[model samples]
Target: MNAREVNTLNIVGGRVIDPTTDADGRLVDIHVVDGRIAVIVEAGGALPSADSVLDASNAVVSPGFVDLHTHLREPGREESETIETGSRAAALGGFTAVVAMPNTDPAQDSRAVVEFVREQGRRAGLCEVVPSGCITVGRAGEQLVPYAELMKSGVTLFTDDGNGVQDPLLMRRAFEYSSDLGVTMAQHCEVSRLTAGAVMHEGSCCSHLGLPGWPSIAEELMVHRDIELVRITGGRLHVLHVSTARSVEMIRAAKADGLSVTAEVTPHHFTLDDESLRSFDPVFKVNPPLRTMADIEALKAGLRDGTIDAIATDHAPHADHLKEQPLDTAPPGMLGLETAFALSVGELGMDLRSVLACLSWNPARIAGIADRHGRPVAVGEPANLAVLDPGVGWTVDRRRLASKSRNTPYEGRSVTGRVRHTVLNGRAVVIDQVAQR
Candidate 1:
């Protein structure tokens, strides 16, 4: 069941929705040859011969999804996830490419580490894995990594995820350096001082549960600081997993101010609230902890109004033993890649077009992979595509997921819009909701 390159594939009877080329839900047939889209014709138009044919009837075909933030956990925590398993999960979730975060055991600060991650993904043969370099050496938040060397290895995004750079001066200098290198700095907007001993959102929920609280101001402060830093250094900045109403407001204002900034919101931040903490489930314990329903409303508003450019799954995974501990002692994170698209469509209630913009094109632009992964499904384009049955419904089951981790927060919840098939490089990686390898 290994993913081998296919010479030709004929996808029939799907509604093509390529936002980049303004193809709005037109019934069409896509023909792929030699890992590229050979032609696209009307549904009932002239046909092309192929080695394989996929019936995409009643499905929506679009450019494959691109996740700007994904934690693959290779070269470190293989007990939780690896590049192969994560890529399987991603293909099933309709994602053809993911930006592997640099928070591994050895850390992806060196060109050697970044190349290892990329090569491992290639051997896995499931999806395109883009490695991000750590903004600071060893992710220590002090010395900057060899940005130019990492860039030579094809790393376009840098971040010290799981921890923001605490020193303002260091961050400003990093921004200045990255600006000159023409790379984007993605920030995990958290102030360690404010979030100390925090398990859930610093709100009535934490108070009622008698637990430590992570305040919204903690994330907002970093967002505001980074926005100002972007203004000063003239560097590209991307705020990751924005969780609060004020954070959304600040990003909206920053966008209006013409700052070179983009922001992302996770599905959990918009779909679930801190009230889920009443059960004291460690699955709900996430960094930049879940906020109130008011914050959810604001995040949705930001998505609708174009304040949030992408809906990235901060797809963190944890081993069952680690995640099963008490909420206060457990690590913060949850499985996301397998459920991101379904939750984004079912919970946000946005049109399919807007959802794809957040899930596909916008994130591709942010990761600088739009040239290959998120191109329009047209003649001569690379054949990375997802065929989605938007009318289908399914419930979350952690045991059925492709990731090695079983830490999904949406277990047993019903969701709309299942991925019928995923095609990567003219090869079907997932068919009929099943992973090929």
Candidate 2:
């Protein structure tokens, strides 16, 4: 992977979409030298010396995607996922970086957990895996985790993701500390009081299935509370995996008020609905469980008109044993890394740049990895990119996914668009819909 030994590798005949530079996804040729973009010349234009070349003739080349939330399941639950497996899945999903959630075995509330996850990602050498810190001691949601200590260890976002901080005063104090430390506080946005023992979204669909429902208020109430807290503390608040219509309206109004607030919606939220849960498939089970189609439309609208800041995968993975239990008793989650891009393009129906903004640049800025990972395709930039065939249509075969967990609801479902190639640091980790390494 050394650059000096390999002088240059040219990526030609691709549509370059560098939103930062107004590339606008036009067809061009990109030359990589010493692991950096040497030049982006016109198609068939003069190119630098090269030992290799990637044919991206039918692909759309854009900055690599950054997942604002990914559960790598390392240090605690390797049976479900590891840094290596998750990163490979991410690469296949057109992601260059992922923020590993802190709710691991030892819980990334301490520096030991934080450093171990970062080192593991480095050792795996698959994708940039940034570790998040817990907002409470041991993620117990009781006492706050040492935010200052975690920040010192390179942690950027703090959350007890599996559970929201139930104590309003404690959450308020967390925001106060977050403002001083300059790290973002991301909330899972569910009121435990309302969601206790609930299996799916509370709605007509849930009533018909006779399943206990997780009311929209469970999520919206917390979102509403957090937005008000952000206004008071002036701390950066990022709402994670928002799943309800009212939640979107709350975030939209907060933005309208010019608050320092940002939010992300999972692909499932915008694409699927609670109706999927009627099958009793645990794969459809998730926190902030899938809402009704009306909610789905609102989520899509939020993404379409820019009210939503990013499209986070919330790529939670679970072991088969965990997910095999009855739908009501099973742990909530599903595989996402390998399906985010296609799902977005197929369901959202927006231009490529807007989609990439949610998948790439916008999330990078939120995760604080913008400088190296989300840059445009041009001279003097790192060769981190995804080449996708925007018009390709395909069905998701869960068995073919790179993740150890196969809990995706999209199995056997036809979807449009596909990631043809993914280049990370000048190497084609994925080429022609296949992972190289």
Candidate 3:
């Protein structure tokens, strides 16, 4: 072994599932050195000498997951979360990189803010934090931000995530500009006109609760608008946290039409319904509120059939005081970074390879980090990997979360999959199911 990796840790005897090569999970031993994969030997192969050896027998090792959408809430709202704490939560959840949402103090519209977010993430060194620039300055939806300058700052995606660009003309202009800059534009997919004063999904649940209603049409109409915009402008459009059945159908049709479009669904959307709000817990209150059981089934089908591209944790963290507010008044978000993978594995019911593809490979490609991450477990690839114990079931503990906020709806909920270890850039960031500082 080279000096850089002679004493480094080696992971062996795990079922490696790398979707890039269509390699179904198989028993293998992987040696990592100098922040890259040095060798991937079959089970019972000759052992390589290293400073430390991790016995991952009976576990599943795969590429670290990539989250295309994450709200770290740093810079402006450190009370909610910071880069360090958020990265810790992401590492525990088996993610190596999380695309930071731009809805921060002053917003991530200008080149300066984008650079600040990237620098903060680098300072933490916990996970690769990519910042997404806002499509409109301050996300007011009035004017477009400097897309080229932001992209030059290494921003691969743009979005006014908390709010969609309301003006059709402005959105079309954004698509045209995004196409030129080669950065993807992700949409929140809500029509303010229809969703104004809305609290939850406009369904039997909302009516029974006597709450303000957010209609499926509000989300569906904007989804349709953006799909058509993608067709006209020939730019990449990514629908974020899609919740409704009709919206899925719209995206399915758009894909059939050959538009460069992609979509992601949150864990709560498929696992929980609007009825969770019957108890009046604000933790279950989310922006694109939960929908009907039929919608849930359709979303699962979309994911299983490859109609959906990635399973991004729209991991929005809100402070306790904020989440404790009245359901209608409280901000709509929940802690997700630490719980996404377990929820995905338990709810998706797919093979290990398929689940990793949705969580790791597909999102890595979408976020433009696939070159360094999401590679097959082979020699010469970057050593960004996660080992998971699939049979170990555990309950969610909100108090132990690394993130500053603990607004998780899944608190105390039983989950099957747990992250055993995470190796990032040849460093054991997480070892033996614990975060290594």
On lDDT, the leading prediction is: 1
Better lDDT candidate (1, 3): 1
What are the per-residue Cα lDDT tens digits for candidate 2 across 1-437? 55457666778899888775453657799988766898888888888767878888978899999999999999889999999999999999999899999889999989988999999997877678899999899888889888888878878888899898889999999998779778899999888988878999998998999898899988888899899999999888999998988889999999999998888999998988988886888989999899988998999999988889999998988888899999878989888999999999988988888999999999998887888888878789998899888789999998899998888989999988899888888878788878887
Report every candidate's CA lDDT. 0.92, 0.88, 0.88
Our model 1 lands, by Cα RMSD against the true structure, at: 1.9
Best candidate (score: TM-score): 1
All candidates: TM-score: 0.98, 0.97, 0.97
Report the C-alpha lDDT of model 3 over 175-231, residue by residue, as the tens digit. Answer: 997797778999999999988878789999999999999999989999999999999
- Separate clash counts for every candidate: 0, 0, 0
What residue runs in model 3 are displaced by over 4 Å at the alpha carbon? Answer: 1-7, 21-23
Candidate 2 segments exceeding 4 Å error: 1-7, 21-24
> lDDT by residue for model 1 over 1-437, one digit each (tens)?
33684488999999988775453678999889888999889997887889988889999998999999999999999999999999999999999999999999899999889999999999988889999999999999889898999999899999999999989999999999889888999999999999889999988888989999999988989999999999989999999999999999999999999998998999989988999999888999998898999999999999999999999999999999998898878989998998998998888988898999999989999998889987888899999999998778999999999999999999999998899999999998999999888
Off by over 4 Å in 1: 1-6, 21-24
